[model samples]
Target: MKTIKVSVVTPDGPVYESDVEMISTKAQSGELGILPGHIPMVAPLQIGSVRLKNGGNTEFVAVTGGLLEVRPDQVTILAQAAETAEHIDLERALKAKERAEHRLNEVKQSNVDFKRAELALKRAINRINVQKRDF
Candidate 1:
């Protein structure tokens, strides 16, 4: 079996680096699946989970919108924020989800940024889903 080198990075640092047989993630346009010898390209990512399959196991990384660069033998995700399933704090994600939901429900408030709250809710849900390996 062959593998591709995958690296998930953020402004803070790298979140994941490994050799994977397949990679699945959500892009702004749609979902993408990459293999070891995938065509080189670039796409904007959405707030979602990145699934890396290797050795009959799948690992998950939660990304908060960024850019994905794919090469024949390598794939790099430069994300604004990223966290692996093992590192995601479930309690914190739940709290963020709650806060975001609260903000969204208060749409009549002038101070509330609906779009930002919606994005936050998406990110929070993404983290929770990734941590649970829902996909």
Candidate 2:
């Protein structure tokens, strides 16, 4: 079977490195699916799930802001911060969502880390979305 070498990395370190049959992820432009031997491209990724297909299975990794670089032979994801569904805490995600929502509601715009809070909320939601799927 044809396989694409894929890597997911953050400033902290590498999150994943494997040979995937295909990959699907949310990009700023839109959702995209990448298969082996795809045309080279570079795109900004959005806050959502990175789907990896291996054999007949698919895995989900929740990613925050990132950049996806698709090359003829490999694919790389450089995420700001990311987490897998297995590593996520639904309760904690809920709490973060609530906290971000609350802060957005009452905090003064100047003093708030609006972008950070928003990104957190999105990440939490992404976790929920991936966790809900049957894989």
Candidate 3:
């Protein structure tokens, strides 16, 4: 089977690099699935899981809003932050979720940044869902 080189990178560094038969991720526009010979293009990604399928196994990566560049033979994700399922700290994600939820509950407070808290909640939930491969 043909495969495409996929790299997931963040400001800190690369989080994942591998050859995958298929790559599936959510874009700001919608969900997208790319194959080895996919057309070259670029898209803005949402905070969600990137699924890389090779053979019978599927690996997951959580990304916090990024830009995805795809070529005929390769795919690159330039993420603000990213982590593979194995590297995601479930406990930390849970704590973050709790904190975000608490912040959201304080929406009445003028000092609370509702949008920031909502984004944090989304990111935490995304990480937890990706870690569980809930997709």
| Tens digits of lDDT, candidate 2, 11-75 | 99988889999999989999899999999999999988899999888888888878999999899
Model 1 ranges with Cα > 4 A deviation:
none
Error of model 3, residue 1, in angstroms: 0.7
The candidate that wins on lDDT is 3
Q: Estimate each model's TM-score.
A: 0.97, 0.88, 0.98
- Which portions of model 2 miss their true places by more than 4 Å? 107-116
- Clashing pairs for predicted structure model 2, backbone only: none
Q: Residue 89 in candidate 2 has what lDDT?
A: 80
Tens-digit lDDT track of model 1 for 9-112: 99899999999999999999999999988889999998999999998899999999999999988999999999999999999999999999999989896689
* 34-77: candidate 3 lDDT, tens digit per residue: 99889899999999999999999999999999899998878999
Q: Positional deviation of 73 in candidate 3, in angstroms?
A: 1.5
Better of 1 and 3 by TM-score: 3
